[model samples]
Target chain A: MTDTITIDDHQVPFEAGQTIMEAARAAGLYIEHLCYNPAYQPHGSCKLCSVKVDGVIQTACTMPAIAGQKVESDSPEMKSRRKTLVEMIFAEGNHYCAFCIKSGSCDLQALAYHLDMHENSFNHRYPVRVIDASHPDLILDHDRCIFCGLCIRASRDQDHKNVFTMAGRGKATRLAVNSETGKLGDSTIAADDAAAHVCPVGAIMPRRGAYSTPIGERYFDARGIDEIDNASGKL
Target chain B: MRSTTPQGNCDVIQREPGQKIRIASCSLAGCFGCHMSMLDIDELVVEVVHHLEYCRGPLNDVRELRDVDVGVVEGALCNEDNVKVLEQFRANCDLLVAVGACAINGGLPAMRNHFGLTACLKEAYLDAEGVVNPEIPRDAELPRLLNRVRPIQEVVKVDYFLPGCPPPAAAFTELFTALIEGREPAFDEDMVRFD
Candidate 1:
């Protein structure tokens, strides 16, 4: 049985096993999501989708909407909190979008634009990451990694190969190659493996025409992912 | 498909393709496009060459394989020979640069380290190709190939890394000029894909 949940002053229906994110989307609400790509399973790592569920700030992406639940998807307090959260991600990682190959076409960049995040609020977490180019078809630049874990799932599910996995814990958690020697190039991953591709950031990109997209003609402005998503009936 | 030049060498470069400083390099076992991108600098080639040397064609007038001021090395060190070639340039050149995705991270060639070398060689030459005898040759002085390719840094340290499939030629020219001027290269932080 699906019933409406009291959210703020309005009532939004909650369906069984319906994630708050999906319900909100169905109710015509835009929640900030970067790592929780619909193509893959919901990865609530970004924490940008945090909403006040029954008066507690919880990740809406992972939490299920329950009956009689009081939710606050957008509020002045939530807006600032979400903006601060996004700023933290931006500052923590070296998200210099202008030079990035994924600059224009990146979801993070689009979200930043959507949220009006001009200045990074958090201090830069200058993590010295290793660049793994072991796979001939793709490159792994950890410096550009936001810990989205899209590649990990794509490798396991779409490619039918467990080539990429998360290693360590907390801030130390990083994407590690499945090689016993702890090297990606040495892994059994083929050139066409999904792990070798599908990097949201330039952290994973093709080797042939590396930055061939040129300056003025990047992914975002050139194609406009929002327009593309709308055209593809995704957004 | 890539074509060879009339001179029997792979003619991957377009002749007089503008005035850009051309650096013909190779990525053995690693991605080979680093050198190809140098030519891909397209119309910017001439502008880039205006700032540096356009060393192309028969290494004749170039004379002596003396150390170049700025050398771009792509691919990883899979064998001793790869190490030697990289080492020579590192020691001889003023600014030994590692370009392309391979030289930066061992790239796709390094993926072979997961499986046995025998499996990889067999799959490529014996299983797929039209070769009769695929076993190791007796008189082949081919240095022992490693089970995987590694970034150039693992074998020999590099002064700079111009990453990408093969980093854009604009980057090469900018980096080369910056090093020559004894200045830290000014990269448009917006231009590089840090992720």
Candidate 2:
């Protein structure tokens, strides 16, 4: 028996428990994703990699690609809906592109621009967000955070230290520091932790060079990140 | 249906060489970042001025107001004065534009609303260390603060909303062109941010 699946009319083999996104990517099919890092477990929050599987939009990162399963990626309807998902993330979060330290290079803003988000179509819901400056070497701007949980899962699975946890629910749910004092400084996590750098927005930034990266050479446009092979290059 | 003609019935008259339009802008109870972004229009500023009237404001040089075809309001109503200023702009100009997040959704400054106006003012004035007069002003003439700052739409109906912390420069250009052409505003999909 073969562990394989048919994706977009192509029969592709996959390992057991492998997600449709991973299998598709392995087959050289590009699926738009921001939250799924190959180096880490899927954070499935981005919803950008959503593809029609059995005629339903589901996160490819978390959803397993099965045998004889059908998948669609390049459809016009899928493209439009994907763009809307990316836009919703831009609107829900306090993604101030101008004031953001990660402006040019930030994944969130870059993805938004790439997806062609010109105006915020949704009625603006400016939720009250708090900034955490407890950690001396790292800053956590909750407003810019999209709750992707890359940091949270990375800290637990890779670092062997569970430092960050989600607190509250719904719009009030926020990433909280796991420590006796409930402050990031008191946590066992280090400034150079994989969790710190995994932040998509300008949320968890190194203290010293927090805003040192100039506007032009920052993160997104001309100064943007090398997204092609960042996992292997930086890791 | 205030204007079936869209914006106004005025037609673009032929102008001699170097002739420009006049424009006026203001920033009230909000960070002037929106104005900076407006000025960031760079060469487009010259183009905007060519077709509109421009006037300097009583406060900042960048801030201005004049009787013109369009009046841009770049802040939310935090007090009675804001209401009056909005009404003045609405009355004086054929078009009123709310620019940026401050003008659109009250921006970060409106975050103070969670604390209420009195507590916010008290925290800055009375609770602070060095102050000539720590006492809250008992004057009746001065405009009293609202319970909370709200978007311009809440106080008065806004003609157009260009939402962003400061709207993207590209959208700014498109909106300006649309306004000048007397066409319905174009909100490019590229300018929309949702999250």
Candidate 3:
């Protein structure tokens, strides 16, 4: 049997263990995803990567690739749904990009641009959160966290430090430190930890790296994030 | 292609046929980044002049406002003068297009919105590390400042919005083409920016 699947018309070949997203990405396709880091297993935290497989919508990261399965992405309807997802996430957080250290490189901001979120489809919630600067080398600005679980996955799966965790229910839910002191400085998280480097937003930042890269020189400055299709690149 | 009204020497318009469109522009409490970006259209300005004529803006030395077919406004409304200029543009133009992030959501100037007006003034005039005179300007001749900087939509009805720190020149080129062709201007994902 041919180990190929059709995604938005292109025939993508896949290996036995690769997920639909992994296969599509390997074939140089850009699927809108926020939470599926290649280093970690697919968590499916953000549903922006939803694609139609055999006329049913499914998250691409968790779906396994199969030969002859027809997958659809980049359709106007799918694009609209992805746009709505981005808008909802944006409204739920207090992400002000102008002053954010990760302004140019923020994944959420880049996604918003990619989806053409010209104006807020929903009203700005303006919810405020505290900035946790207790960490010596890294500061956790809770306001910017979209609760995507990248830090949680990175800390636990990659660092094996379990320095971060989720707590509370629904709206009250938040990213929390695992230390008894409830402060990042009190935790074992170091500036060099892989978890500290994995935040897609400005939430987890090294103290002195802000503004090190000048504006217009950073990612997604003059070009869209999808301009290049590097098979090994992280979106 | 412009022709002055022989009767009303004050009013000048295109002498050509009914195809010419008048356009005016204004800059508010901003760094004029949008204007610079517009100028980046380069030699295409000659082609643009063939369709649209300047009414009142820094593009010319004219210090007065005139009736126009379209008004392209940039920057945030931060002071009383900005409000007056915006109202003038609204009153004179048939359509108003808010250009750039400042016109869309108040942009960087609206960063002051997080802090109250008094606190911002105090920090800038009295409390800043390098401040010397430490006096908030209260001259009667000066325009009064707004409590917070606001987007153009906050002050007047905006027909369209082009979002960017300074939207790329290609965006302006596309917008002008659409407008000149009598179609609704559109911005795709490639042309808009949040940061």
What tier of docking accuracy does candidate 3 attain?
A: incorrect
**Residue-level lDDT tens digits of model 1 in B1-195:** 111111111122233433333342444555456666666656755555555563421222352345355566777778878887677666656555667655655555655654567887778767866778766533568777876656666555455666555566666656655543445675443323322
Whole-model lDDT for model 3 versus the true structure?
Answer: 0.78
Model 3 regions more than 4 Å off = A2-6, A11-18, A64-69, A91-100, A167-174, A214-217, A221-224, A227-235, B1-19, B46-50, B57-67, B77-92, B116-150, B153-159, B177-195
Question: Lowest lDDT 10-mer window, candidate 2 chain A?
Answer: A226-235
Scored by lDDT, the top model is 3
Task: Evaluate all candidate structures by whole-model CA lDDT and list the values in order.
Answer: 0.62, 0.69, 0.78
In DockQ terms, which candidate is top?
Answer: 3
lDDT, candidate 2, at B113: 61
Better of 1 and 2 by TM-score: 2
Candidate 1's TM-score: 0.50
**Candidate 1 chain A weakest ten by summed lDDT:** A226-235
Over A1-235, each residue of candidate 3 has an lDDT whose tens digit, in order, gives 6599999879999999888999988998989888877888888878989999999999999999988899998789889899889877865666667567887777888888887776544544445467789987888988788887888888899899999998987878789999988899999999888899888777888897787778777766766656632111121
Q: Candidate 2's residue-wise lDDT over B33-57, tens digit each?
A: 7776676777887778666556644
For model 1, give the interface RMSD.
15.9
For candidate 3, the per-residue lDDT at A209 reads: 72
Report the TM-score of candidate 2, chain A only.
Answer: 0.87
- Docking tier of model 1: it is incorrect
Candidate 2 accuracy as TM-score: 0.74
Task: Provide DockQ values for all models, in the order shown.
Answer: 0.02, 0.16, 0.19
